[model samples]
Target chain A: MEPDTQNGGGMAKLGIWLVVLLLIIGGIVVYGKRGEDTKKASVKEPIKIGFIGPLTGDLANIGANTKAAVEIGVDDINSAGGIGGRTLEVVYEDSQCTPAKSTSAANKLISVDKVAAILGDTCSSATLAIAPIVEQAKVPLISYASTAAKVSDAGDFIFRTVPSDVLQSSFAAKYAVEKLAKKKVAIIFVNNDWGLGLSKGFSEAFKAGGGEAVFSEGIDATSKDARSLLSKIKAIKADILYLLVMPGQAEIVIKQAQELSLKISIFGADPLEDMTVWNNAGKAGEGVMFTTIGTSPSDDFKAKMKAKVGSDEIIYSGPFAYDGLKILGKVIGEVGTDGTAIKDALYKVSYEGGVSSPKIEFDQNGDPKEAGYAIKIVKNGKPVVVK
Target chain B: MDIVPQLIANSIIAGSIYTILALGFNLSFSTGKFIDMGYGVMMVIGGYAVFYLSKILGLPLPVGILLGLVISGLVSYLAYTVVYKPLRARKASGAVLLIASLGVLTALQAVIAILFTSQFQTLSGLLSGNRVFEIFGGAITAVQLTTLALGIFLFVILAVILKYTMCGKAVTAISDDEEVSKIVGINTEKIIGSVFFISGVIGGLGGMLIGFDTGIEPIMGLPWLLSAVTAVIIGGIGNVYGSIAGGFLLAFAENFGIWQIPGEWKSAITFGILILFLLFRPRGLFPK
Candidate 1:
């Protein structure tokens, strides 16, 4: 009776193995069939593009805002039936606002992802780091926020929706000298591409306009103590203090400057458009004037961004980022995904009624033509546009 | 340079903060006999605790501060028990313990970032207003002056306690020889645990004061840690007074060093001194 039971158990085990084998065979066949289906569906494959930004670092706030705006651009493109029935998709990579990381991210996007075009690298250093690579690959890259003046000569394939610091620096320098009647300016900037570019340009412009640059110094990005620098500037008796620092450091500099009783007119670049800096600085940031890229989002775009980000306050580059992706879509629609073709077509592609600017047109340097600038002053704990 | 007075004031303020940091780190280092790299994050923990409790939860300033100190102390004690103690029982090498402390530092910093969203915050905003003080033709803030006083006060209190108290004797014995200390009827584990708690409190105080003076970030501890470690080594690693002297010396070198150069070279000047000390004066300026 025991032997008979054992034989019955063996027979049951054999039956179970047979069923499992059959199921494995069936799964492979089903999976292979789905794979073929995907191949057939390639006709409707999405248009691929790459995006690079500082997703998780000191500059992450800017990255988050620009990334959301780009996502909105992708949504807008798809909802409008996409470009020639193919949906738009973006491959996002975090550069962390460093040149080395940006280079690696660009390489991955170009080689691994094989994206048709690239949209970002929010920091000027990151953009410059990848410019030669994109230029070599003949890939057209457009920047949404980088404003460093040297970006104008980075590469022919490089383009930016925002104007270069050359324009903004001259604008600010003129305003400081002519409008504010400030003769002596002390320039302290973060020792990075953005700060270096803006500070040097502003100093040159100010000096050329018959204003004296009493002192110009560079500090590390993570520096929290500015007492010595402030004291030196104060001793030199500068009437205007132009700060070219990241938003976080801006608060420290302003507060420390206030504590030392070095009361002077404080000015900054576009990065100060952030309300977080003013809020952190509190009353210390009062009357701090800064220059930012001039562009107004349309009501429709503003409403979309509000619903998308759940806040009416869009980042300063939000409209520019949306316009950048949309312009790429338009260019890709006119010309196929060929790199040089896209590069050539971007110059001819004149987009009007865009959210960032009223009209977007690329010039000889691949920069937007005649981009305007706006001056904002911190008042009562908020940045109010004065010009 | 007419900026001499301000430079001196800046050095003193920065030096005091570093002195406080060095004192906390040396206490834990002496007792544990291993570099507690994780000691730096205690400052971040304390600063963030107060920021959340007082700034966000609307708790009273003193209550928030006391709770913050306790929280940091508890975290340090837990780290010692759950990580360092177990590793020490297994006879881990100094290198192994150092790496473990690094892991602790990275993990705690990430946790803080996740909770606070990595935004820089200032506790000074909660104060009604900031008062400026003048000294010898140099302007100093009320916060800076208080930070200076606290650093000196902590140094004296620690010096007295370590020289006279029974707990201090036990810690010194353990630091000298842990096995010998255990065989001599000393409760080594309990004493080390308490030492870690004290270290955390001192580190937390430094952090809170810096937050009020400048601001706070999860990454803030690393730079401060680098400075303190350099101070500890240069001041004679186990000597309490060495840390104070080393802290002030490094600050003076850094502040005055940048007088003729660009401010961007400040860190370069600091690490340069550190490397010189490591090569020429490994036992430090005040070697025991």
Candidate 2:
């Protein structure tokens, strides 16, 4: 009976493998036919570029806003005579704002999609995760939202529309000490490259500006509970609590801190620009301020995003995404869809009247050449820039 | 020094949530005799059900919660009948059952994400404000207090039922020896079905409380699953009362262990204790 059962199991395994082999062969035939179809339609076969962002998970809202902006950018370019007679298209992949997922997405885009250039990976961690992959693949990887200082050194092929945290942290430190009269700060950041970079930069800048970092610690990015961590921060009695967290979790931190009645002013980084933080946090988010890279998305762009997304609320990164796509479209149009040529063209390209910035250009290290900082405060369920 | 009281309060609050999770997990595992990874998605089902009914459809919160429990229970029972039971009838190995459950977990989680769009949502909007209470210099919200009370109440009720009820006796008999239980004319499948339902109800309650306390996301259940499983192992696998003890102990150790260390060390501390127990006392503190 045992030998009979073993033979039956072997047959089943063989049958499964046969089915798998057939499926693989069928897939290759379909995929090969599709490639030929694209070649046949070569006259206007659309310049396909890849996009990686947090389309799902904790940061999905921010991704949604940015994605809407990118969609608008694509629409705008297509309407303007199809980017030198070839319509531009975007192939988007969800990274879930995780490094591991971002790496896999990058590999898929590079190997399978074979995109001319790649855009996005909104989170700094995700951008960094795909940096080596893109560098090795020689893909011109342009990010709209990632701002960690480490990203500047990721690779020659890596570029971002957003300014590094190095500039923002120093700007925030100067503002806190000089404008707000805040001396001692307690830092609680999500334990990721973005958070660590901001905390380290802020602490160093604050110390240089004649202020003290009273307490600092890192927590898991996905932590739901912050009471104990808050308790520890509360014990320090710092004047300001500088929290670096993602959007969805930031609301919880604000609400929990309010519940704990921590008697310190709260400050945050760019992620607080998300409307979800303001809406979900409600009263708790009132008066909370955050530093973000300055952007002035055109009024027309704002109207388009509102009409598209059913809301006028724009994530701070939205304009950068819009600008990033526009830049990519221009460079790809001029450089003829070669990744190396696009990367070289990007370094010399200059744009005026972009939604993100008045003039956009990339420096030697692929950092944004023109970076301005704005401090925005949440009041009455909206973020208003503080002049 | 002043932070100690709050830390203790925080520990208790965390412990209570873990206890609730461990209880549901332990009850189901004792009867099924296989690690049901899909058990976690039952909480997501409940949480999303409540979110849809209460938040979107504007149903009364109580009605939504009750229906959430019903839906969660039905899903859990269906999983057993549709998936596990047929496989059990085929005499599938425990590992195969575990892998099947993992498939259920992934598929259900993906469905929830597609339905709800994977945003972190809060149920506390039903209340005008989550009232905060001070206990030993630590602040806990009304939702957390409710969770703590529910944890204790469920523990007592479960203890009573398991100790005295006929269905409980049948479950015990089956867990002890399924073949012997069948020979004794006990309907093991029906009893196990009910066991899964009860666990599902407990999991739904936990999901609601956690939703009110923190928030709900599709992936939220995975973390709670890990925490609860750790609690069950540390307390004593298959031991009902030990889940409570292990939950509190694990929470306390995690909360206090990071007093002088960074909060990022919490997971490490949790697993460190888990490893210590596995190495020294694989049967757990209160061996069943």
Candidate 3:
């Protein structure tokens, strides 16, 4: 048999079928045209705001929380008739907490989502990566937590709602020197931009405060054993411990230090404020002190959050998220959908109160310029204001 | 002096972990003649499995461990069967297999993230209870001591089997020459399968120990994998005893390296040694 003959009798029937297919496609096109005209009359066009953060990875919690915060802001605005009378919508892009990915996410949010603004990013590295993306797109991006000093100064288009590392680092070191009343301190930080940035600032502030940093060491961010780290800190006979690991490694160092009976005052940066400390270290974490960007959780914030979320999962994380959204909304209303205008609005704006903290404002770099770190100590299973 | 014992003890402990992972990594690479990057993902999957069973589902720790082991072992076996087996049949290059392993790594990490979320989770409450023990000069938790014992136990069991058992001899023969082992009337497929299962077991155990010590997270696989690989490469690839010695050496060196310098330089020291070795003695301390 010929090779073409093997195609079967069905192949010859295709000429008539092609004509029928075109007719069917033409009918559908007519229906779509009619439907498009009708829908334009009824609903208010939604203003799409893009959100970029790590929804997956080691830093998913902060990423997820920051993303949610942006959404909450949009939700509040849309519920109240939105900006320029258009409903607000958020398009989320996952950054994986890397600058490269964050930049890609920024581009997609701008080109694909066609969003007027963006909210993101818990990591400073990601902030650095996307700074150019947002600037080129001229889309105002208000970050919930990226606090690296370079992030805010990236361009006029970027702004940060969270407090800067500068304040937190200084506050953390100061807590060790003054509050813990320790004259000699040893620092153990993770090796990274976040760790390095904080280390430089903390050392300067700590030395100025008249405390000697006998040792300032960094371990791999993912180090399996920090006992060697603890040993180095212990050898210095440091009266205070300055640690800057993420929640997981922090617990290891804390628990190991406790086991060794190396009872020194523990001072930490903001990431240490995660619940993992109490969850993993338990009683061993008692008396630890740390400084953070957010306003302390007040009773009023708790009550309001409970009323808003009613979900046990988001209770702790929701307010900061909600605050992030509201800030974005307020900026949008004042800035008139312009990225630069919104960035400018973040500079002078003040939040009356929000879930994670009270009264939010940013300096020129989009960082909470005047934002001071609030020092808190663990006592009786709760973080009490120490200063 | 205060830091010396601490650093030594810490390095030994850290080395034990690296050895656990490195031993398994080499086991697969040696026999298969290709380094499977998926070895690290197995650890994350195992940890996430235990976390789900024990913490989320509220099962007993031992049961969770068993569940984790079974799930992880089965997954690795399937990975070999489905992905590696097909690729090998196609006469795929090692680079191709490496790419497949990266894909598996991504998909597995995504699954873990979906199931457990991206947050670092620790097994606490009944999963982790109070048990602290002290030694002269420095101290470690009962959990840490238990991990050390398990590491030693697994090493002995593996060494004994590899040396004495017929299947073990087949594995060695395969590592030496796959074609020769198959021509000698040994079922290479069966032998490779068994090796994969053993490697998976070691990986699962490594994951469990890490859960007991440092917390577990989906993103932890690579860096942990890197450390183990560092030990394996430094000690001499496929040399079990060398891997063991390499692990301890690295741990000890890392601990001792940070003595006069700040603690943060600890990673830099480990990475620097890895680089120096790669440059100067790439064949490692005990090259095969």
Best by TM-score: 2
* CA lDDT, candidate 2, residue B13: 90
Please compute DockQ, using alpha carbons, for every candidate against the native two-chain complex: 0.46, 0.68, 0.55
Superior by lDDT: candidate 2 or candidate 3: 2
Per-residue CA lDDT of candidate 3, range B1-288, in tens? 456666666766787888888889989989877778888889998888888888888898899999899888888888899899889878899999989988887788878878778777776454446576656676777777777787787778778888899998899899889998889999999889878887887888788788777778887888888888888889988788867887888888877876666666766777888998899989789987
lDDT of 2 at B164: 95
Q: How many backbone overlaps does candidate 2 show?
A: 0
Error of 1 at A377 (Å): 1.3
Better of 1 and 2 by DockQ: 2
Report the candidate with higher DockQ, 1 versus 3: 3
Docking class of 2: medium
Lowest lDDT block of 10, candidate 1 chain B = B125-134
Every model's TM-score: 0.91, 0.95, 0.87
Clashes of each: 0, 0, 12
Query: In candidate 1, which residue ranges exceed 4 Å CA deviation?
Result: A1-41, A133-138
Model 1 is docked with a DockQ of 0.46
